[model samples]
Target: MATTGGARPYRPTLRAMSVVTFNVSGVEPVQGTFDDLGTPLHEVTFVVFDLETTGGSAREHAITEIGAVKVRGGERLGELATLVDPGTPIPPFITVLTGITDAMVTAAPKIASVLPTFLEFIRGAVLVAHNAPFDVGFLKAACAELGYPPPANPVVDTADLARRMLTRDETPDCKLATLARVFRTPNQPCHRALADARATVDVLHALLERAGAFGVHTLEELTAFARAPSPQQQRKRHLAEAVPRAPGVYVFEDARGEPLYVGKSANLRNRVRSYFTAAETRPRIREMIGIAERVRPIVCATALEAEVRELRLIAAAKPRYNRRSRFPERVVWLKLTDEPFPRLAIVREVKDDGCAYLGPFGGTRAADDARTAIHEAVPLRRCSERIGVRTRRPACALAGLGRCGAPCEGRETPEAYARHVTAARRAMTEDAGIVYAAVKARMDRLAAEQRYEEAAVDRDRLAVFVRVAARMQRLAALTRIPQLVAAAPGADGGWDVHVIRHGRLAAAGVMPRGAHPVPYVEALVATAETVVPGPGPTPAASAEETECILRWLETPGVRLAQVDGSWSLPVNGAGRLLARIELAYQGRDERPAREGRPLR
Candidate 1:
């Protein structure tokens, strides 16, 4: 006869002739305690389960029965056993294997009716099974068919635990029946769900005892033990012990106390702990960890602040493992020489020379592209030889090619070359329309002739020029402001304020939570150092510093508190050229096509 009970009550069972009491419940279990290594194995609640199905494939099979035993701190809490009607015919071969005949399940409840009760019984417990993927796969499939998300409980497979815990001599195979004999469980294999589940409970305890010898006392440690640590990682495990569980940046330093790497994370302790695991695949990171003697963390109030601090720290420390933004001072700039001819030149350092400057580009390549765009539009001198007012110099080949005005050979008078220089400077600094119009006209001509590849090249060149020009113009505008104060609402009801003097960050701090920002703002400005504008060609701010400030200013809810100088873009500025360039690149030209045939 089939039993109609929902769930079996916990029963007192004898272990080694001593009777042990057990508690049974269907409600969610209370959460266990967690320490640094995570919840101890003894305190963790586990649901040891096994499923009998029609076939091996989850997608093609249907569950015939389910058996589970919930245990906490070595005490059996409850048991669940049910025969589910698959809603399909039970094959003759399946009956021969499990002895569950079609007649036996005809009166059983359908899987849809039994799954809910099983899920409720196992809530707030770690799932355990011998060959867990088989059982978990079927349960997850049923959940999906019912339009419910699969249970997210962490699973432990005894088959995997056996491989990690026991030697081949102790257990010749990882099969449940083989492990059952080796562990000497009270129940024997009977090809039934409840019998196998009761047997698995004993196997779990045996493996836990073996795991304890390797210092795997906690659930997290046991889960991670398969990827065993190396001698080096084990020795350095103490480095991550003191890191706090908070959003922040971590600096890995060597014996000399020099930073080897810098990284940011929302949880400092967990992120740092991952480095000592087998999951860390980067060779350079492993090398850094091997050499690291200490790990330092700087906690931040918010993720945004952590990112900002990471950038600042990387720029300041130039850590060996850090690859980007290491040398902000090495960023190149495009300078128009302070001379009569005033040719465009790529320079590493910004000077206070009377020439117009275009960039703090990350590399010379971007500056070269911008220079090419300007030269194609305005016929400025292309020669590198220094030319004086009366110094006689022969014309370079560019002069004959009509690519240069050739101020070197006096072929173009100083006055005439100065006009070209002025046009180039205007395209570089105040307005990019002059150069953008030329590039766009060429791109449109190419597209009209169906020479799309050449058109793309011109389009890319214009993109580089316009982007750099817009950035340079914005930085220049900000630098013109003698003093500026901006503030944004920070995390935890505080205000993050920045003081800028001539485009450089003069002072930055946060107003305490629940405090009025007006007084803090006044005090910040009063104590800020006065940064006088220099007469050199270099702007007051480095490109990295200016970019950082720009990012902060463009934040979604940022507000301008005060501005002693104008913070406005020119009416004919390069900012206007961006839209036109984008439109041309999209194959839409607002201007009429030229009459001439497209150049090859």
Candidate 2:
């Protein structure tokens, strides 16, 4: 389907193959799970075909001729060429181009009879064509109309294959006639079906030889070998061959073994191999694949452990390819200012000065949102200036509006303001019932008055406040414990046991059904890594790691095996309040949808 173009004939030389990384870094994850390249190229049967249609559109056109050649290992097994009698008269322009006059095809076989034969010939063999979509589209459209199932054979485009190796410096463009001339095939195209297909066969063989230098010798590799991946990506694909099909982390590195990217997946082999496939469309990932010289896989006992390891590795390496979670220390915390008249402050550091902290928020906006919500519930001062017992300043508009106690003006006593501080502190660390109640009352009053927008505004503030408070309290409880052992039911009734030290995953294993948990738990704890506790809420590990541990422990059906200290929240805690706020939000969100209004 290619027209002749003025260009110089040339052949391209591929870069020489280099050393590849085929061995995995850590222990084998799971036996017999690694993917192997299927079916070598020379062993595959390819049906190279071409078609001459009456028009450009597959829906509007009819096939005038079908020509194909079946080949294996550079030997032609058979050739199929037939004039298809389109029921409709052939267009004048098409007749002039293909030289197939109306009288010549007046008694030829109809497409309905020819389709069954064509489908049978291409069955179980890879189909090859130039600009394949045009030819394959017509064949598939005919099959759909004639009650015949579409052929399932894989397709390869010599046009695309030529583009992979030939650049503009060597060839002006990728066209069937151009390639046929460049490769100097025995058969030449003259707008005839059989001749063009035969010309494409030689072009394919030359392209395959070029592809062989890139390590694309298998049918699977050829399909994924679209643009002929960079020499590194094509060669480094073997690094994923030895990985296990289990939950773990994978690190891509440069030739010097410097980390380029760190990621985790429930199945390590499948995820790592995706990098070398056409399915990975991210431009940055493709670039990383091009630079990657090796892949280091670390298999974990559980998915949660894999996730925790990914975060830790990303934070440690600060890989340029990863866009998030590289600098956990940059997170902000909402600290209750330790003073005579305390106020909520969004600070970036966590100190051991005995001040109540509420977060490790990823951004200042989230910390500020939660702070504003808490201020809506409690009459805490919002001034940036520090205030002590002896300090004095004029009352602001908030104090005049009765929103604050005006401790700066000495209009409110420290003793009297201490009560409000106590309530705010309790909301931050232990319970949020008072904060949730105060906000809910205001929201309900606003809703009853038909001020839904105002009510939603209050709801937004309360949402962030309750969620942060609940999350921080959960993290604090677990991080305070010196050691904890827990188990969750795994597949086939096995138990995924974990030893957590100060909210960090120290050791983990899978305990078979009917196995003694106490002995297994004891052994795991004994072998667990040592963690020297730090100060503040997160003592041994990061706040993110503590949150991960909390989520694993809170999963349904998970049972506690052992604990070194008490790990409990207040009876009236933020967990219940967080659930109520979530339910209220769900209803508010659904109301707009049911009423046909746009939802936020």
Q: Which prediction has the highest lDDT against the true structure?
A: 2
* Count of clashing pairs, candidate 2: 0
Candidate 1's TM-score reads 0.57
Worst 10 residues of 1 by lDDT: 1-10
RMSD of 1: 16.8
Q: What is the per-residue lDDT of model 1 for residues 363-390, given as tens digits with 9 covering 90 to 100?
A: 8988888888888799887666678677
| CA lDDT scores, all candidates in order | 0.78, 0.81
Off by more than 4 A, model 1: 1-237, 244-249, 264-282, 299-309, 391-394, 447-452, 529-538, 579-600
TM-score of each: 0.57, 0.60
